[model samples]
Target: MAYPTLRDWLFSVKTFAAAMLALYIGLAFELPRPYWAMATVYIVSNPFVGATRSKALYRALGTALGAAAAVLLVPPFVESPYLFSVIVALWTGTLLYLAVSDRTARSYVFMLAAYTMPIIALPSVMNPAGVFDLAISRTEEITLGIVCASIVGSSLFPSRLAPTIIERTDAWFRDAAFYATETLSGRIAGSAISGARQRLASTINGLELLLSQLAYDHTRPDVLARAHELRGRMQLLLPIMSSLADPLIALYNSGRQSWPEGLEALLADVIKWFNEPLPAVSEGYHPDASADALRERIAAMRPPAAALASWDGALLSNALWRMKQVVDVWQDCRSLRIIITREEGSWRPHFRHWRLGGTQRFYDRGIMLFATVSAGLAVVLACSLWISSGWNDGASAVTLAAVACCFFAALDEPAPMVFRFFLATGISVLVAGVYLFAVLPHVHDFPMLVILFAAPFILVGTLIPRPQFNMATVLVAVNTATFISIQDAYDANFLTFMNANLAGLAGLLYAYLWTRVTRPFGAELAASRLLRSSWADVALTASTLPIEDPRNLAARMLDRLMQLIPRLAATDDHRHPSIESFRDLRIGFNALDLRRLTGKLGGEAPAAIAHVLDGVRTYYESCVNRRKREPVPESLMRSIDAAVARVISQGLANAAAPTATSPTSARQLRDALHALIGLRLSLFPATLTSPTPPEPETAA
Candidate 1:
């Protein structure tokens, strides 16, 4: 355990102050459950000002919405507790689905609303006539806490989120750079490359979450724009670099001893450039001119149209072209970084290949539905037991169950997390018991209360910022505060306290058991689902006509890849086929390229390309049906080769009649050749064993 730094201490202090302020305000108003106000502070307080403010806003909105729901829901079904319990369970499940679907901080709203209704409504069931007042009081206390947290967090030594975002972005760039150089230099392959890529993808996924919260960070418009633009470019870089690995591996695997003339020099130069440190943030600086110089070298190395007829030339062309794209994206990333850091620059957005208007992500409705439904069932079972036993404090159990379920619904396996919550709640009960019976009895003054609370709250507050301990610390701090039920006058009823706190423990125990039974499989299940989803996506991309926007398709596929990469690391399930996500991504891109170029390629070429698409679609469909990995059939290879030969023949003819071939036609032919070659390389890298040495025309 690393010692708490100054920043962590500051966060702890600010959060504790916010909680006390909220408590004082709640006492001044004499609202029931004023400690709820204090609990809410720890629930939403983030180290960063913007995150705290954003959570405050969302928590308030969700609280009001839930309180209103309880008011509307409780009175009508108050006499029918069983029906009411069912309704509440359904509401929790349905909303939990929405919460888990969104993989961002914004998901907090739905999650809060999911459990908040139960928290408010379940307690009000015993006193139906006072439901409205109860709802109002709950909302008022929570809102009071939210207001205090937002004010204290933002006003006192606010930590800006932009610098953190910049730091994360720089770290992402470094990992990507390392992966790129390693792949380019032929130092890593197989599992090594897979591990490295997984780590990179994981970081990119994290950066996406941080970027989603950027708007709440008080970030300048230009920097925000640059950040979004850079995100798209960074996503594009994955495929570009990933695709580059294929042809490099193919070149080496084809019994080749060395790179084509100038190709080795070019690869070394590009690697060197990727490793070069970015210039310090300064005014009026630009990176494009330097990027252009390297791009020019790449352009010079491209094989002529006549040379593309051979497999070696096509592979060489694809490799060099992808390298150029990598350079372009890297340069743009650097430019965006400089501007984001300096917060001032004349640099315009340079990378526009992908026009991702807004973030597009992948969601698995099946898994989400299963997870949420299980949570709802848990709530129903808990409520049934509570109603049958006539336990008034059982409302706490049901409410905690719902809250715990919603909190962890997004995890692949939430049982262990729920178990931790169970343990944390147990700890909180013990601590709150000591404070209630032993310590708070002598605390007759508010200042004394503050001093007594300081020891535990401040200590737990530091742990809240660390990821591993975040959930448990937040629970302990928030639960302990509410469990003590601190008010204007110290009211410690031993029976009421034990019943309530124990019911909470029981609720968490139910949640853990239910989650364990429901989600027995861990990351392996999620990983399998993601891989199957990729195969389905590949099949759809291949078969679709008027092909989807390449940028949009790329974004969705890349997003899915990033999500899958981490799960792959976590699970040891070898049930998955010997397929690389990058290979799948490359295949998808190649299919889209061929679909787009079908119109541009006149003659027999379009028909041959269509055949390849049909074969790709069929193969993936079979994989989906058989529920196993299928080998790349030789027929698909024939189709791809036939398509390539036709495209090359057509292109050579066009070149023969220079006046008849427009620049656009020439470019289209080159694109078709590159896509076909990339497709073949991705599918059958090992089969192409013949090392046809590069000819002079294509070598340099």
Candidate 2:
């Protein structure tokens, strides 16, 4: 085990202090369950100030909402225990579905609300008239604990998430740069690239939680905007970088001797540019002279009109075009990072032409719904047993089952995690049992209680900051606090303690078994669903007539790719799916770009482009229907080549007679040519032969 750092020790000290403060206050206020106040401290405490505060707010709101729900519902259904259990189960499930769907820190509110109803209401079912008071008291105690945690966490040696975000952003950019450089220089290994891409996607996806916490970080609006802008550019960069691999690999496979003169020089220069460091944020952000220079070199190296009609020329042109995009996006990322990290600045965005997608994510509703329902059923099962057996402490069992269910509803396989919870809670019961029977009864006063609690609580709090130990330590700490049942005065009963703790164990065991039985498929189902969703999206994009922004399509595909990565890793089906997702992302971009470019191309070009798109739609639709990858038809290849030939020929014709073509018309023709070339490359990387160009005289 790694030794704890000073920061971990500090966090532990602060957390222990907060817990004690909450306990002392609860005792002074004469709360019914003073230990509950102490337990709440651990539940909401985080190493970072902003995260702690955010959780505190969510926990407070969820607690109030849940308390209100219990106050209103428990009285009406108290006389009908079976019907009440059913009602509670539905409430938990419905809220859990929303919580799981959100996929954000905000989901905590719904999750807490889901389980909190059972925690408060089920215990008061026998005393219907007292439910309201019970709810109020529980809310007050929990809110007090939250307030104590927030104050202690934020006010003492507060750790801000903003700096961590900036640090992570730097690391992400460096890794992406390394991947891009390796790919461009033709030295990247397949496995290396795969792992790099997965890490980049995971980092980008993981930032959502930290970014969500930024609002509570006292971050400036401009800084927040810069952070988000940097994220969007990073998303934009992934597919472009991945797309560059195909054309470059194709060119490399054709042999170094076939490379155009100065092509390697140009590639070296671009790689050098990526390796160069930018000016620091304190120096104030300036334009990246290197990115501009690299783009100019790339533009100068664009194939001549005659060469554009050849297979090698198109491949070279597409690769250079994508390289230029990577440079532009990288420069934008640098500017945003500098701005975000700057201590103070008045900054203007350097890149605003692209309309990036919003925060809408791809949630597997079917799987999430199934998981939520399973969680609800676990609650129902626990309740039925409790009601049937007339167990006096059965309320704790039902409450814990609901808590266990809500804790990991968002995971692909929550069975293992639930099992961990069982073990942690079991350990906690033993520890709490010892303290209740052997230790606490010997303590007569608050300071003495604090002295006794210090060693264990502080030790466990230190482990909370380390991710591997976080969940287990949290369960142990919180459950131990709850189990000890510290009231306004000393009251320790051996039988009462065992009954409640055993019931909790029973609830957790049921949850574990229920999850294992219901979710045996694990990540495979979710991974397949994400893949199918992307296929469906591609099919829809290809068939739709109205122009869609390629950026939005890129955003959705990239986001889907991010979500799919971890699941793919878990299933050990990584390589093939990663390739397909990247290919689909590139295809979606090319398809959308083609649709937009269609409005600019005239004559046979639009007809040819429509043919290619129709084929794309058909191919993807077949994949979706078969629930497997369908082989691309030779007809699609023919159509893509036809579209490329038409666009290139028209573009050449326009260039040959400058007087006949407006600047706008020439630019449009060029864009269409590039899009068609990209589509051809994406669909047929192996096909090297280009169609015959039209005769110059016939073009004129």
Candidate 3:
């Protein structure tokens, strides 16, 4: 048997209570006929409909404004059904446009107006005199519903947004620490590091979103300011985190004897400082005496200890340099403790890729709008058909509106959700109608109805917090309850509701299938392109250098390599076949990092290689700072070309086994070698150049 989570229990109790309250209001007041429609106002008032409070408020306001507009216009235009339809269509279109264009406060206002047209206007066509009364009644019911839902939602197992923000912040910090440790250990190579960086960026973006949601809750400004300060500190930590790969790889390859003395102790201190509460004094004191002792032990071993006896002096120096950077990061963290504590102000909008702009955004918006309008139309058609017939005691207009709200609100993902909405709406309508017509006629007690409604709500609510099938099941109960409660009595409309729902399900299924067919191969192609691009960059960076440059070109190259790390991580799918290829690309980048460090220290004769490495590092550093994949420097490219030519020339002349070989064979060998070098060069052009056609081997 599956266990119920905290969310499940909360949702069950709240939903049941809301349903009971709606019933009481309808029964006690002896409201006019179409009690089902009034009850729908309560159902549509769910907070989840809008996700955020502001959006929900906007949606409510839109509903009210649109309802009022419908009442005012219906008296004059209700006689002409065609005119009313046109007015509703125009209003809906305008509202949708506002929703799309104005993402802030005004967006929801427009959307509410757009959606109100069919619900309020279409129902008043038969009895124009009743339009004003119906609109007023709906406004009252909806307002009451919103108040009740909000009160219950807030009091009953409310998940406070602030705590979520703090948790995400802590998670991001943990991931960052893990990434740093892995980079230093040499366990994560080039592409993997890139992937890690990408993950870090995404986590940061999520944190930003959380902070934004929290900020909207009318919290104190001081708390919000503190969150902002903490976020700034984290942002400052990004570059330092990216730069640790070089020292880490150097330490990993230095052999045991070449390892920095007390390096492990320093690492432990860094982790402790990050994980533990801040020390009282930021600068020269340690809260834990043992941590101080460890630092002292490491400092004593620093210049030369047992660990360094067999190691080269240069490697030791590089290790110390990297360790000092880590120490500096810890010191910054300690100083920013206050900022981290003030968890309120960190909220900001999420970072969306500017590259995802232009046509793609427009298309997504269009799909959402189409889904919403179609859903509204479906609801209106169902209600109109039911009313036109003499079956007056069946489902009401309000019931249809409630269904529309739930279905259309989920237009965020139109394809998959369309069918789910249809199924939910159809089933709810049938169950409610059947209970009223066949079951309710025999049972006169309110207690039975409460129990009957409670059973389904409890079952669905309890199942809703699970990971996979929660949504589908919860919708079933919610839609059913809404349908049952609103209508005064159920008359037979089972087949009509079922067929309409089936049509909705079909629309959603078609959209889902169509999207898959149109977007096939995007993931694999994206991964391949990213992999090839990163590889070409690594190769080009490795081949170039500026002679006599003092800046450690290896460090620069490592920085360049870090830029690709995130891209590689983003392209990963645990099940993809090309994952192995991605792994190879990562290893190749790490190898380049290693080669760069060795070249810098070995001080070999090809001074041009050193200069090119420096240029590569510079370009990489620039790219990181700007958060973009910039062109490789021209100076670096020319130097790489010259070095490749020189290497090829030397290899040809120094062919050791000068056997009696055919001239054609020699020519072919020379051409192949040159082509290989040229291909590498073409991979990392310093400008906007078309990608070279892949050779058969690379393509394979």
Candidate 4:
């Protein structure tokens, strides 16, 4: 590895100190195993100080919870090892499902909880009386390690997440701005949009981790609201950029699209601002107000009604309209930059203003349910084989298999990961044996023990941030420390150690077999279920639920959109889910607008409009319950036309009043009409194609 920075060296030093402290504490207290505490120091240490504390707390809780379960479970089934094994397996499986569902540090608690009982109980099957004492010892050692790691990380010039968040956001904005320039410059390649989508999505994901750490930081809440604002604004940009690109692409294909006058100038301004050297956080930044001027110019210069429908006029209209939108989005970015710099202290309303709702990872219940059953069954199988063979080390196999299954719970293909872990475990055993018998005899003091172990731990801290072999490094370090089993009085027996290690290998071998057999299904069921879920949201949108805010609702559905993109991209099959997923995105957005538009109705909307919504709701519900593609009734189609006319007249009548609320009415009507148009396209795309209607919905 390349030489680490000063921060990396500091982290390594802190982790090493914590591990030695944990060992000393355990030895001084005469705990059964000081090594467990020592090893946990490495396991819980995180570069971010707050993350270290968070993980430490969760690990402690998980250990205690697991120990409590072992205490309750081990004694009753001692006589019948088979029944006990099955019960334990089921417990691990159930908890494993919950563990993988949350893709955060919190998952550590559930994973530890799932395995803690078996770790204590399995070793004492023949001597069940010792189970409670073993569980207590295990829990205490683990908790001691957690406490040591947390204290060391928090005290030793701890790394702050706030500065990292700022640096990361700046880099992300630069990439996005470059992409926007390429898109507007008409140099966009066929793959560019998808690549941009993935990059932006990944950035959003990374930001969320930093956002979660904000509570642990001393940063003012008003400055943090910019992140929330940026997320919402960024989400809007992708769809708008995509929508704008489509018409431009069509015009380019026909050799009609050209950059509108001053469009490149407006785009250049945004690019330059984003690419500028970032100022210190205290510096004020006034956003370039060029967007409003460009928008007004475009509005004033729009073509007359007749020429707009012609091919040449259509090309210019699409280019100018989308350019204005791009400018608007860039302006929003500059506004967010100003807030992030904390330039305006008077905006106290922005403090604590960011609320993250509906940001959970989308785990299909089917996957979780499938994993829970497989984990339990794999354990039961391992146990039955051991019990029938009358193996003294059979409990080892049962516990190892159960723990391994839960450990790889989040992986789609567990067999490969299990094999990697198996390799790491064997390497750990060799290292542990070397230290147990070869080095420890001469190391008579705690300080000498720390010196002997310091190099190995420093290596772990060095390798922790690596992407490729980090997991293996972790397992080797953890397994070696755990297998050494340091106590006040050291006992190193070759036969007993070899037997335990071999049993663990056997358990992992069978686990790999089980994982290969019960591999996660990648075909239709998950895709179908997710598509149906989006339809259910549409049905909800049609219900009496208030639609005052669609951001939360949209955010939740957008998560499923991300899920669908990857699944569809993985397959080469015909009738891909991507088409349906794209349709669902449009449907979800439209449903929100439809709901909002309907909410503002004062019994003035045409009665036929109500009937049209009812029919659409029925169709959506049908899609959810069964994958039926029931087309909208021709009568409902006609009513949509009538509703469009009603909305247009109302918008026009309100146009004369021209208050702040007038623009809102205009926007609502436009959104409602856009939803109706999208509904028409989705329901009967091939058969009922219509020319693009004018803005006031004057087309039949």
Cα TM-score per model = 0.95, 0.95, 0.56, 0.81
| Residue 468 accuracy (lDDT) in model 2 | 92
The candidate 4 region of ten consecutive residues with least summed lDDT is: 347-356
C-alpha-based local distance difference test score of model 1? 0.82
Q: How should the candidates be ordered by lDDT, best one leading?
A: 1, 2, 4, 3
Query: Global CA lDDT of candidate 4, please?
Result: 0.68
List model 3 lDDT by residue over 1-700, tens digit each: 6688766677667756865776567666655533443344234433232234544466579878888888888888766655555566556655665565543444656766766655676657667788888777766666655555565666665655655556666666676667666655554444454455566655554454455545555556676665654554454355444334433444555465645556665665655555664433344442344434544554565542222212133234334543544555444444444344543112322222111112111123444455455544544444444455534332343233333443344233334544565566567666766775677677656777777667766666666545375557656665565455444443446666554444444434443443333333433344444444444444444444432322232233223333333334343343222233333233333324333333322112135345445555565556445644465555655554544343333333434445644555433333222222332333242121222222222211
Rate residue 22 of model 3 by lDDT.
62
lDDT of 2 by residue, 475-585 (tens): 999999988888877788888788889998998998888889988887888888999999988887788655355565556677888888656542223236776677787
Q: RMSD of each candidate?
A: 3.0, 2.6, 13.6, 5.2
Query: Which pairs clash inside model 2?
Result: none
Q: What is residue 409's positional error in candidate 4, in angstroms?
A: 1.4
| lDDT of all predictions | 0.82, 0.82, 0.48, 0.68
lDDT for 12 (candidate 3): 64
Q: For residues 278-298, could you state the per-residue lDDT of candidate 1 as single tens digits?
A: 887654675567678888888
Task: Report the lDDT of model 4 for residue 92.
Answer: 87
Query: Candidate 3 — worst ten consecutive residues by lDDT sum?
Result: 353-362
